[model samples]
Target: MSRNASASTRIRVAAGAAVLITVACTASATALDRSAETRSPGTPREAAALTGSAKLYRPLGDDITFTFDAHLAAEHRMDPAKATGTFRFSHYLDGRGAWAEGRIDCLLTGGKVAVASGVITRTDLPGAQGNRVGFTVHDVGRHDRLGYSWASVGNPVETKDLPKCVSAAPFEKVKNGTGDFRVLPWDPDFLKEG
Candidate 1:
């Protein structure tokens, strides 16, 4: 073939390859997104690690209680799957499980997935926050996927059953939607009503 014709054919081949690659990546992303959405609404929508009954999580705080209405995203039979929630970060548990709260709907999917539609404080506790929490939880969730939960009680780091997240109260600085991983600490100072 002539030099110009050969060059033209090469360009066409390169364009075709690029198109194929783009299509593949788009399909993968769509599959993941759909998986996260297709699950039964009550089931978790992301993935996680943790199979034991006495499982644990980093708590948000004792000051706030939360309730969510989560819809499962299209996902695999994975644990700790990233679920989509629409709920309020209500009030304190009256030192119990909690009562009133507010709700919102946002997309909180990381390797960080939590159990939705329950009394969070009762179901989980807290964990290390910032870098450590993100890194560990991400790794663990990806590997195990659909084994654990994403909820907290108060100060999971304060609990004695598990190890400390760090020397400092890791989340004492970055407030809201962040924490370290640790078992839920039952409050000795917790009071209740009759």
Candidate 2:
């Protein structure tokens, strides 16, 4: 039973973190899109309690997130139109690094679907894996959006040491937002190859 408790704790912590990234990534992506086009962002909202869990939320304004979310579209089969979910955010690497996760919730598609989510961890001020995970629901134009993903390390090109995979242009936010990106039922990995 004791072992079970520890395992449970790990699961809970991991789950919380996943939720955070998902929410942050989605919100971040939207902000990125708006930033690039020089357009006003959607009505921002104070992140209410996502379900009953107590997950601290924060505005995503960096390249690590931008990469991860874009990577998702390139890698994970995340539907831009419906890949949103709740997330939990927590500090990592003593304030330099951060991690977040997104959990898929029920939707209007009709049939029962499996829940989904993603995580972005950065180290070296990036998180684990010396990188961050990003989830993005993108606007494919024509009022359509497909999902995006990117997993990378370093900051948004500002810092001299930032990696080639890093770009801050995608994740600049002016205010706090709520409810991460929506979720799709397709296998995420399949999208990466395309």
Candidate 3:
């Protein structure tokens, strides 16, 4: 009788341990799911972030240049139309420099290409105050490209009239080793061959 009781007690303890482990695992998984939902709202997971900078010289003249610095976060599913971050732009012409700093309002990316837009909050650039500007970056290994909406869309009489995040395809090559930009993809295989 004692042997049978001992066996029964051992069985109960083993069963109790198994139940406890299962409960712990389920609770952990539930917590993880809730965390992901909060981070990306309506998505199962967050998209990868983007960051890049460039100092591209225009082909029209050696003195003409456009510089860009950006840090853009993944678009939240709740606000699918926008990406949040900072973008600073600088234009140089005939040795004079004008710059604007703003928050990145829009971003679109595919493979190695990324286009972004921002509204100028502060600037020394005339005619750019309270206006949205666009930019494009193509991340090719040795021969990257960059484009400015002011040049691609043509300098509009009213900068505010320019469409948000609109820019022509990146056509100007980086002039030298001093210029480059990167479009980091979530998957390494998504980038195109150079």
Q: All candidates' lDDT scores? A: 0.33, 0.33, 0.66
In candidate 2, residue 5 scores what lDDT?
100
Local accuracy of candidate 2 as per-residue lDDT tens digits, 1-194: 69999999999999999999999999999988866565335422211111212212234533222111211221223343243344333344334655444333211121112222333323333333322233223222222221222324333222333222222222322122322332222333343476
lDDT tens string, model 3, 56-157? Answer: 656656443444444433445334245667777665767776777777776666688878777788888777778887778888976888776777445532
The best candidate by TM-score is 3
User: For candidate 2, which ten residues in a row score worst on lDDT?
Assistant: 46-55
Write the residue-wise lDDT of candidate 1 on 40-159 in tens digits. Answer: 655553332211111122265545422234433335333222333333332343465423221211122233433222222222223321211111112132122222112243433332
Poorest lDDT segment (10 consecutive residues) of candidate 1: 130-139
Q: Is candidate 1 or candidate 3 better by TM-score?
A: 3
- Cα RMSD, each candidate: 17.4, 21.6, 10.7
Could you say which candidate leads in lDDT? 3
- lDDT of model 1, residue 132: 13
Q: Where does model 1 exceed 4 Å of error?
A: 39-194
Model 3 lowest lDDT segment of ten: 71-80
Cα deviation in Å at residue 155, candidate 3? 3.9
| TM-score for all models, in order of appearance | 0.23, 0.20, 0.61
Pairing residues by index, what is the TM-score of model 3? 0.61
